[model samples]
Structures are given as structure tokens and as C-alpha cells.
Target: MSENNSSQDSRSRIARRVFPDGVDPDPRFTLANERTFLSWIRTALAFIGGGIAVEAFTSEIFGSGLRATLSIVLMVIGFILAAGAAVRWHRIESAMRRKTSLPLPLIIPIVSLASALGAGLLVLVFAGLL
Candidate 1:
């Protein structure tokens, strides 16, 4: 009986978080939100894997330094994006439950970081550093 009560309470809390302000949010939306979060995680893993691939597979051909740096940076970006995605997903879900507008993430930072990485790689490749 106690276990059942605890489980029920947990479900209630989840439902409350997922349907705050009595907005009558659909259960399907919750499942979609979960899927989106999972997608972000997969994307992050791919980025990290790409980085490793560059170092492992291309190391013999392209050598090291510039290419290695690019790979590592990409991997770092992936990790950052993954973490950002998790936080954003939760925030969005909670805001939806509360019927509040979602917050804008750090788009400028993300863009600048990506641009810088790309430009650096381009310069290194053009200069024959890679």
C-alpha cells in the first residue's frame, strides 16, 4: 500500500509539472517532449563521435595539430549543445505546463563559437597547417 501510494504521488507530481496552471496539456505532448530531449542527446553523441573519428581515422593521412584541434573543438561543442539541450527541454516543458512563454537560449554564443571554429579550421587548412 505504501509503495503504491508513493508511486501515485510521483505520478501526480509528474502530471502536475506537465500540466501546471490547469492548462489541460495533452499526454502525447509529454511523450514528444521526451523524444526531442533524446534526439538532442543523440546529436551530441554524434558530434563527439565525429571528433573521435577525425583523430582516429584521419590521423594517418592528415597528421595532427590543426585537424586534431578542430575535432576536439567539435566534440566540446557537442557536449555543450547536449547540456544546453537538456536544460532547454526541461525549461520549455515546465514553461508549457505553467502556460508561460519559453525563454530564448544563448543563440549568439552558440553561433559565435561555431563560426570561430569554422573560420579557424578554414584558415588552418588554407595555410597548409592541416
Candidate 2:
């Protein structure tokens, strides 16, 4: 019926290869989702920037080997965060289109655990225990 046609129209408007079903979501909701997506991108950039700053400014505090490892770890986390944000955005958008309950954000706990471990590593390094 008309609903099916509306779904088809929505699916065809953007990347047809992605989310091939479901009606168009409210524009306000979609814009809000996009803003959240941008926020995650900013967070990812902060992680990457922090890694660069540590590598560039901590030479006096950390040996080259330790600095390199820490820098790489932070940058890798940033990359993972950016990728996860993209996937999460798509998942949320898909759910919205389908009128389904959104999925729980799995990134929060994982990022929290990672950040705690990183902070612990920093503490150990600063205490000359690492």
C-alpha cells in the first residue's frame, strides 16, 4: 500500500545499498542523530590529539620505547572509536527507520574500561614502576 511505497521511496533516496527498507524517519530525529555522530567524531579526534601530544611532549618523562607504545595505543583506540561511531550511527538510523527500539550503546562501557586501563598505565609509568 502507500506505506510500502513510502518505505521504498525512503530507501531509494539515499544509499540504496544500505538500509534497504523502513520509512523515512522524522527530519528532526535524523538531524539529532547526525549531531551525535559529529560529537563522537570530535571525541575520537581528542583521543588522537592526546596521543600526539604525549608523544611529542613527553620525551623527557618517558623513554622512547614507552612513549611509542603509549602513543600507538591511544591512536589505535581513537581509530576504533571512530569506526565504532560510524557503525553505531548506522544502527541507530536503521532502528529509527524501522520504528524499533534503539540498541543500547555498547561503546560507553568499553571506552570507560579502556580509559581506566590507560590511566593506570600512565600512573605506573609516572611512578617509575613500569
Candidate 3:
């Protein structure tokens, strides 16, 4: 086999190993999974944008050190969310393929709590309390 074909075969083998039962899930469910993944990616991008906006627009208000720290925190959270989304997508897809119960979504609460904290910090900054 050509190198590319060999690579594809290896990947297929790995996927088959991961889902030994190898049942094809409903197309609608697969599509929904993909949509959810895309939404998470969009959310991650938004977080990154927010970080950039904070650094760009709030340096004077927050001071360079605090602004950069907040920006980094936002960006890191975005990165974590993006990675978690991929893992969640894989787990859900595998569970569906295996006719098993879906995995619990743990990222939602983390994101919610982080968002609340970030919002509170922003309020403090804007109110000159930080």
C-alpha cells in the first residue's frame, strides 16, 4: 500500500480497536455530535477573543501585569475548553457507537463557574475595586 493508504489503514485499525463492537451510530446523532464540537470550538474562540480584547483595551485600567495575567487566564481556559470538547466528543461518539450511556458532561460546570468568576473580576476592574 502507498504511504498515505497505510497511514489511513493504521488509523482505521486504531479506531476499530477503540470501538471493538464497531456499530454504526445514527447519522443524526453523529451530526449532532459534530455540531456540539463546533459550538465548543466557537466558544473557545470567543474566550480567546475576550482575552485579546482585555489585553488590548484594558491595559491602562488594569495595569500591565494584571491585564496580562487576566488575558493569560482567559486564553488558558479557552485552551482547556477546546481540549475538553474534543475529549467529550470522542467519548459521546464512542458511547453511541457502542450503544452505551453517554458520558457526563463535566466541562459545563467548569465553564460556568469560570465565566462567573471572570465576570465578577471584570465588574471589580470596571468599578475600580481591583
Candidate 4:
């Protein structure tokens, strides 16, 4: 192959593939979407770590089955969120790259649950239950 032809082939490989007769979109938008997904994954990881920390540290202080169960439940939920995040991020990224609308994740339910749990914890702490 000629030098110019080989260089063109390399460039094509480096660039994102575009589907014929599909949406005309900028590659930068796809990249930005992917970055956003990664950020969400990081946030999920932080949530998981925080939950684990709370469970591990407070278990001894609470000295009660209820406290321990609550802490473990938080940690388990965090782990579930982290796993869901990875799957959701992948789906969103894939859809964005394909020039399709991203689907909504289950974050709404998770967030609501977390908020309720947080309120319960606060109530318990204030009442000297934990």
C-alpha cells in the first residue's frame, strides 16, 4: 500500500465509527457522555466506601443487633448501587455512542430509599436508640 493510503487507514481506525443513514452527531459529545458516566461510577464507589466505613466503625459502639443490622443494610444497599451504576453507565455510554437516547436508570428509587434511611438514622441517633 502507498504511504498516503496506509495513513488514511490508521486515521479511520482511530476515529469513532459512524453508521450510515443514522444520526449525524459529534464525536466529542459521545466522549463527554462517557466521561459523565465515569464520574457517576466514581460517586457510586464513594457511596459504597462510606457505607462500609459507617458499618465497620459503628458496630462496636452501638452494641446492639438493630444497629448492626441497619449498618449492614446500608452497606448492602451501597454495594447494590455501585453495581447498578456500572451497568447503567455502560448502557448510557453505549446508547450515546450509537446516537440514541439514554435510558433512565433506577437511581430515583435508590435516592429515595437512601434519603429515608438517612432520616431514620438521624431519628434513632437523636432518640439515643443507637
TM agreement with the true structure for every prediction? 0.67, 0.87, 0.84, 0.62
Candidate 2 Cα outliers beyond 4 Å, as residue runs: 1-14
Structure candidate 1, residue pairs in collision:
none
Model 3, 1-130: lDDT tens per residue?
4666555553476765665554678999999999999999999989889889989998667889899999999999899899999999999999998789999999899799999999899899889898
Residue 12's lDDT within candidate 1 is 69
lDDT of 4 by residue, 18-50 (tens): 321233347787577668666766766766676
Evaluate all candidate structures by whole-model CA lDDT and list the values in order: 0.73, 0.86, 0.87, 0.66
Write one digit per residue (lDDT tens) for candidate 1, span 10-100: 3566665454443444778768878977887887788789889878888665658856787888799788879877887777777777677
- Indicate which candidate wins on TM-score: 2
Models ranked on lDDT:
3, 2, 1, 4
Residue lDDT tens for model 2, 1-130:
3667657564455555587767778999999999998998898898899899989999998999988988888888898889989989999999998999999998787689889999899789779899
Off by over 4 Å in 4: 1-25, 59-61
The clash count for each model shown is 0, 0, 0, 0
Query: Candidate 1 lDDT (Cα, whole model)?
Result: 0.73
Find the candidate with the highest lDDT and give its number: 3
Error of 3 at 96 (Å): 0.2
| Candidate 3 similarity to native, TM-score | 0.84
Sum up the clashes in candidate 3.
0
**How far is each candidate from the true structure, as Cα RMSD in Å?**
4.7, 3.1, 4.7, 5.8
